[model samples]
Target chain A: MGEFELIRRFFDRGDRAADGVVKGIGDDCAVLAPTPGWQWLVSTDMLVEGRHFLSTVDPERLGHKALAVNLSDLAACGARPRAFFLALALPRADAKFLEGFARGLFALADAHGIALAGGDTTAGPLNVCITVMGEAPQGQVLLRSGARAGDELWVSGTLGDARLALEVFRGTHSLPGDQFVQVRRAMELPQPRLALGQALRGIASSAIDVSDGLGGDLGHVLKASGVGAEVYFNALPRSAILAGQDLMLQQQCLLAGGDDYELVFTAAPEHHEAVKDAGARTGTRVTRVGRIRTEPGLDVLDSDGAPMAVLLASFDHFKS
Target chain B: MGEFELIRRFFDRGDRAADGVVKGIGDDCAVLAPTPGWQWLVSTDMLVEGRHFLSTVDPERLGHKALAVNLSDLAACGARPRAFFLALALPRADAKFLEGFARGLFALADAHGIALAGGDTTAGPLNVCITVMGEAPQGQVLLRSGARAGDELWVSGTLGDARLALEVFRGTHSLPGDQFVQVRRAMELPQPRLALGQALRGIASSAIDVSDGLGGDLGHVLKASGVGAEVYFNALPRSAILAGQDLMLQQQCLLAGGDDYELVFTAAPEHHEAVKDAGARTGTRVTRVGRIRTEPGLDVLDSDGAPMAVLLASFDHFKS
Candidate 1:
C-alpha cells in the first residue's frame, strides 16, 4: 500500500465530531473549528533513539508512548485534547512497523477523542515528534506558576511503576509471566490522565507532567511557581513490582528514573477535597505526596519527619 | 549555557506580533490566538542528513532554507506567514551549530514578521522538521484546484539556479567565483514570495510553490484543478548563470530540477495589471510564463513555437 493509503486505513478510525476536529488525517492540512469560550493549548515533544528510548522496545508501544507523553503535557495544563500532528522519521519504509505504530497511536487517540490531524514522513534515523493541540475555557487553563506556600501537592496514579518496569526490561529484575507482562505494559504504554486534568482546572494551583521522574518534574513546578515542596517519602505510591527491592535502591529509582508520564499538580489547602473529588469522578487514583512550602528548594522527609540526605540532583537533558 | 539560556540568547529575535501567535518561543507552550475571519493554513516538512542536504552546506543556510520551504507552502495557498515551530534531531549538543542555525532562522522570521513559537530538540542524526502556520481569509485560500481553462499562468523569480548550484557543488561543472556564489546562495536561501501570496488571494485562480521543480509542482495544480497547461519557452525566466549553458540541458534543468521555492500561479487575464502592481510593491520581479488550456496534460513549446519534449522528470522525496 502507498503512504497515504496506509495512514488513512490505520490511523483514521475515530469519532471526529467528539474531538471537535472538523478535519482529520488525509489532507494537505487539517482544519479545526475552535470550541466556544475556549483557548487552544499546543505543545510538542520529540523522542530519538539512544536518547529517549531503547531500540528494543516494541514499535507499537513506542507509538503509544510518544503520543502519551504529549498528552501528559496537556494534562498538566488542564486542557482537553483536540487533535495531534505527528512527524515520523524512519530509517526504512517498513510497512509492518508503520502498521503497528499507527494502530497503537490511533488506539490512544480514539480513546481520548483526538484526531490525527496531519504529519510529515521522511527518511532518517528512527525518531518521532508529536505535537498535541488541546482546549481549555478562557482563563481556566492551569499553569505551573500558581502554587502558593500552603498548597498541597498531589500526583495521579503510581510514581515508580514505569521505572520498575524499566528495570525488568533491563534484566536487573525477574518476575513471573503475568507479573512481567503487567510491569512491561506499564513501561510501554502509560495512560495520560486527561479527564482528571480537565476536572482539576479551576482547583489546582500549579501543575506539571512527570516525564523525567517525580523529583525533576516537581522541580519545574516549584521553579515556575517560586515555591518549595516537602515530599513525604513514606507517602510515595509504589507498585507490587518493587515489593522486595532494597530500600535505598527503591528510593533512588523512584526519585531519578524517568518516563512516568503522570500528572503532578498542587492545590490550595481549602481545595483539597474538591481536587480529590475531581480525581474520583475520573476513576483515577490521586495521592497526596507532598505540600508546597515557603522555602525555595525541594525537601524529602522520612516517615518520622526527618529530612532525607541529598544525593543526586534531578535529571538534565543536556547532561544525561 | 543551559537550554533555557541558550534559547533566550539565540532564537528569540523575531517579531512576536504575527497574526495568530499570542505567545511565541520561550513559553511552556505557545498560545495562538486564532484569527476570527481567517482559516488557518498549516504544513510540515522534514529535511534529513544524507538525504535532503549535504554535510558541507553552511549551518546557517540549513536553518534559513528549512523555514523558507514551509513558507513556500503558505505562499502556494495564498496565506500570510504567521508563526512556526521547529523539531530538530541533532547528533550532539553543538553550541556553535545551534548559534549559526538560530541566527539564520531568526533573520527570516524577523523579516517576515513570523514568530518562532515552540519546538523540540533530540539527540540523533541531523534532521530538521518545521511546522509552519499561516492564515487566509475565510474561503479565500487559493488551493491547487481552482484553475480554469482560460486562466493565464505566471511565475515569480527564476528557476534552476539551486539545481545548478548543486551540480557545481558535486564538481560536475565549474563556474566563475561570482556566478558560483550567486547560485550557491540561491540554493541556500530561496526567498518565499509572501507579499505576492497575500496579493494573489483574490486574483489567482490557483497556485503552488515550485519546490519539486516547475514540472512536478505545476503537474499537481493541473491534476488537482482537472485542467492542462501550455508553456512558452521564450517566456521562461533565466538567470545570468545560465547564459551560456547547453540549450537542452538548460531547458531540462529549468523544468525538472527541484529546490526552487518560487510561486507558480494561474490567474484571470484581467488581473495582469494587479499582479504587476503587487510585484512592484514587493520589489520582486514577476513574469507571464504560460496559460491554462483545455487539454489534460502539459504541453511545452520552444521559442520558435514548436513542441518540446521533456527528457527528465521532476524530483520525488521518497524515490529520489
Candidate 2:
C-alpha cells in the first residue's frame, strides 16, 4: 500500500472529532485553537526497535508505550493531553502490525482524550517519534525549576517494578510465571499519571516523570531548582517482588533502575495534607520519600536515618 | 556522553530566546504562549538514513533539509513559523557531525525566525523527525480544500531540479561538475517558500507544497477541493539544467519528481494581479501554470492547449 493508504487505514482517527482542533488529518498542517487561558506544553520522544523496545515486543504494547512515554512528559508538566503528531518509519506497511499497533495506541489516546492530529509515514527501519501537545492553565503549570528548599519530595505509585521486569528480561533475575507477567506488563504498558499530574498542578512545587530512575530524575529537579535533596532510601515504595530481593539489589533497582513512568514531585511541608488529598482524589498512591535541602548534593538516608553511600548509576542510553 | 549532556552541548538553544516561548530546553515539556488572534498549525516529517537521503550526505545539508521539509508544510498552510520540536536518533554521539548539523539547522532556523523550543535525542539508527508549530491569522490560513472552479493555479520557485539531481546520482543521467553541484544543492538544501506562502494567505483560495512531485501534490489539492485542474505543461518553470534535458525526462521530473519544497496554490482569477504582487513583494518567482476546473480529474495540456498523455506516477514512500 501507499503511504497515504497506510496512514488512512491505521493512524487516521478522523471519525472521532476532537475539540480545539480546527483542522486534523489529510491537511498539510493540523490547525488547533488554543484555549484562551491556557499555555501550550509540547514534548517529543523517539522510540527505536531493539533500542527502546525489544524486537520480540508485541506491536500493540509497543504502540501504547510509544505514546505513553510522550504523555509522561505532559503529565510531568501537569498538562492535560490535547493532541499529538506521530512520525513513523516502518520496514513495510504490514496490515496486521498496523492494526494491533493502532488498537493499543488509540486505546490509551482515547482514555486521555488526546487526538491524533497529524503524522507522516515512510519506509525504513521501525521507528516511532511522537510530539505531544498539552495545555495547562496559565501560572499553574508544574516545572522542575519551581522547587524550593524545605519542600517535601513525593512520588506517585510504585517505583522499580519496571526495572525489575527489565532485569528478568536480561536474565539477571528471574521470577515465577505469574509474577513475571505482572512486572513485565509494568515495563511494557506504563500508565501516564495524567489525573494525578493535573491534580498536583497547584499543590506540587515542582515535578518530573521518573523514566530514568528516581535518583537521576530527581537530580534534574534539584539542578534546575538549584537545591539538593535528602531521599529516605528505605521509604521508596516498590513491588513485593523487588522487596523480596536482596538489600543491595533492592537498593539498585529502587534508586537507579529506569522505565518507571511515575511522577516525582515536591511540595511544601505545610501542604502535606493537601498533597495527600490531591492524590486521593486522583486515585493515585502518594508517598513522601524525601525532602528538598539548601545544600548542593543528594543524601539518601537509610531507615535508621543514616546516610547511605549508594553508587548505582542511572540508565543512560549511550553509557548503558 | 550521556543524553542530557549531548542535548546541552548541541541541541539546546536556551541562549537565543524567541517570542512566545515560555520555556525552551532542559525541561520535561516546553511551554509556549499562543498568540490570541492566531490559530496553531502543526506539521511533522521524518527523514531516515538511506531512505529519504543518501548515506554519504553532508550532515549540515541533511539537517537543513530535515527542517526545510517540515517548514514547507507550514508554508503550504500560509502559517508563520514559530517554534519546532526535533526528535533525533543517531548511531552515535559524533561531535563533529553534530556541530555541522547544528550549524546548518540553526542558520535556517535563525533565518526563518523559528525557535528550537524542545527536542529529544537518542542513540539509534540515524533518524530526524521534526514537528513544527506555526500560526496563521484567524480565517486567513490557506487550505487545500479552498480551491474552486475558475481559480488560477500558481506555483512558486522552480521544479524538477531536485529530481534531475537524483537521476544523476542514481546513474540514470549525468551532468557537468559545475551544473551537478547546482542541482545537487537544489536537492539537498531546499528553501521553504515561507514569505510567498504568508503573502498569499488572503489572496490564495488553496495551497499545497510540492514535496511529492507536482502531479501527485496537486492531486491532493484537487481531491481536497473537490475540483480538478488544467495544468499548462509547457509553462512549468524549470532550471536551465532541467530545460536542457530531453522532453520525456522533463515530463518525468516536472510531473512526478518529489522534494521540490515549492508552494502550489490557487487564487481566484479576479485576484490574479494581487497574487502577482504577493510574489513580487516576497521576492519569489511565481508562475501561472494552470487553472482549477469543476471536472474531477487533472488534465495536463501542451503549448497548443491539447491534453497530453502523461502517465507518470507521483513519488510514494512505500511504493517507490
Candidate 3:
C-alpha cells in the first residue's frame, strides 16, 4: 500500500469530535482551538526497537506503550489529555501490524478522550515518535520546580514490576508462567495516572512521572526545585512478585530500574489528608515514600533511619 | 555522558524568550500559553537517513532540513511560526555531529523566532522527527478545502532544482560544478515560505506545500476542494539550470519533482493585483500557473491548449 492510503485506512479516524480539535487528520496542519484560560502542555518521546522494546513484542502492545509513555508526561504535569501527533517510521506497510497497532492505540486514546489529531508516516527502520498536547488552567499546572523544604513526598501505584519483567526477559531472573504474565503486563501496558494528577494539582507542590525509575526521576524534581529528599527505603511499594525477592534485588528493581510510569509528587505535611483524599477519589493507591529536606542531596533511609549506601544509578540509554 | 547531560549540552537552550512559552526544556512537559482568540496549528514530519538525504550529507544541513520540512506544513496553513518539539534517535552520541546539528537547527529557529521546547533522545539508527506548533487567527487560516471553481492557481518562488540535484547524486544526470552546487543547495537547504503564506492568508483561497512533487501535492488540494485545475504547462517556473534541460527531463522535474518546499495556492481572479501585492510585500516571486475548474480532475495543457500526456508519476516512498 502507498503511504497516503496506509494512513487513510489505519490512522485517520474521520469521526473525531474532540473538543479543541478544530481540524484533524486530513489538513496540512491540524487546527486546535485552545480553551480560553488554559495553558497548553507539549511533550514528545521516541521509542526504538531493541533500545525501547523487544522485536518480539506484540504490535498492539507496542502501539499502546508508544502513546502511553508520552501521555505519562502530561499526567506528571497535571494536564488533561487533549490530542496527539504521531510520526512513525516503519520497515514496510504491514497490514496486519497496522491493524492491531491502530486498535490498541485508539482504544487508549478513546479511554482518555484524547484525539489523534495529525501525524507523518514514512518507510524506514521501525520507530515510533509521539508528541502529545494537553492543557491545564494557568497557575494550576504542576511543575518540577514547585517542591520546597518540609513537603512530604508521595507516589501513585506500585513500582519495579516493569523492571522485574525486564530482568526476566534478560535471563537474569525467572518467574512462574502466571507471575511472569502479570509483570509483563505491567511492562507492556502502563496506565497513566491522569486522574490522580489532576486531582492532586492544587494539593501537590510538585510532580514527575517515574519513567527512569524512582531514584533518577526524583533526582530531577530535587535538582529543579533545589531541594533534597529522604526516601524511606522500606516504605517503597512493590508487587508481590518483587516483594518475595531478596532485599538487594528488590532495591535494585524498585530504586533504579526503568519504565514504572507512576507519579512521584510532593505536598506539604498539612495536606497529607488531602493527598489521601485525592488518591481515594482517583481510585489509586498513594504511598508516602519520602519527604522533602533542607539538605542538598538525596538520602535513601532504611527502617533504622540511617542512610544505606548503594550505587543505585538509573538506566541511561547512551552511557549504560 | 548520560542522556540528561546530552540533552542539556546540545538541545536545551536556557535563553528562550519567545512570547508564549511559560516553561521550556527542563519540565516533564513544556508549557505554552496560547494567544487568546487565536487557533493553534500543528504538524509533524519524520526524516530518516537514507530515505530523506544522502548518508554523507552534512549534519548541519540534516538538522536544518528536519525542522524545515515540518515548518513547511505550518506555512501551508498560513500559521505564524511559534515553537517546535524534536524527537531524535541516534546510533551513538557523537558530540561533534550534535554541535553542528544544533548550530544549524538553532540558526533557523532563531531566524523564525521559534523555540525548541522539549523532546526525547534515544540510542538507535538515526531518525529525526519534528513536531511544530504555530498559530493563526480563527477563520483566517488558509486551507486546501477553501478553493473555488473560478479561482486562479499560483505558486511561489521556484521548483524542480532539488530533483535535478538528486539526479546528479544518483548518477542519472550531470551538471557543471557551479550549477551542481546551486541545485545541491536547493536540495539540502529549503527555505519555508512563512512570510508569503501569512501574507496570502486573506487573499489566497487555498494553499499547500510542494513536498511530494507539485502534481501529487496539488492533487491533495484538488481532492479536498472538490475541484479540478488546468495547468499552463510551459509557464511552470524553473531555475536556470532546470530550464536548460531537454523538454522531457524538464517536464519530469517540474511536474513531479519532490522536496521543492515552495507554496502552491489559489486566489480569485478579482484579487490578482492583491495577490501580487502580497508577493511584493513578502519579497516572494509569485506566478500565475493555472485555473481551478468545476470538473473533477487535473489537466496539464500545452502552449497549443491541447492535453499532452507523458507519465509524470510523483514520488511515493513505499511504491517507489
**Native-vs-model 1 lDDT?**
0.80
In terms of docking quality, how is candidate 1 classified? medium
Clash pairs, candidate 3, are: none
Per-residue alpha-carbon lDDT of model 2 for A178-205, expressed as tens digits?
9999989999999999999999888999
Over B93-173, each residue of candidate 1 has an lDDT whose tens digit, in order, gives 788999888878888877888888888776678889888878788778887888899999999989889888888887988
The alpha-carbon deviation from the true structure for residue A126 of candidate 3, after best TM-score superposition, in angstroms, is 0.6
True-structure lDDT of candidate 3: 0.92
Chain B TM-scores across candidates: 0.95, 0.98, 0.98
For candidate 2, the lDDT comes to 0.92
* Per-model lDDT: 0.80, 0.92, 0.92
Top candidate, metric DockQ = 3
Which residue ranges in model 3 land beyond 4 Å of their true spot?
none
Task: Give every prediction's interface RMSD.
Answer: 2.2, 0.8, 0.7
Interface RMSD of 1: 2.2
Q: List each candidate's DockQ score.
A: 0.49, 0.90, 0.92
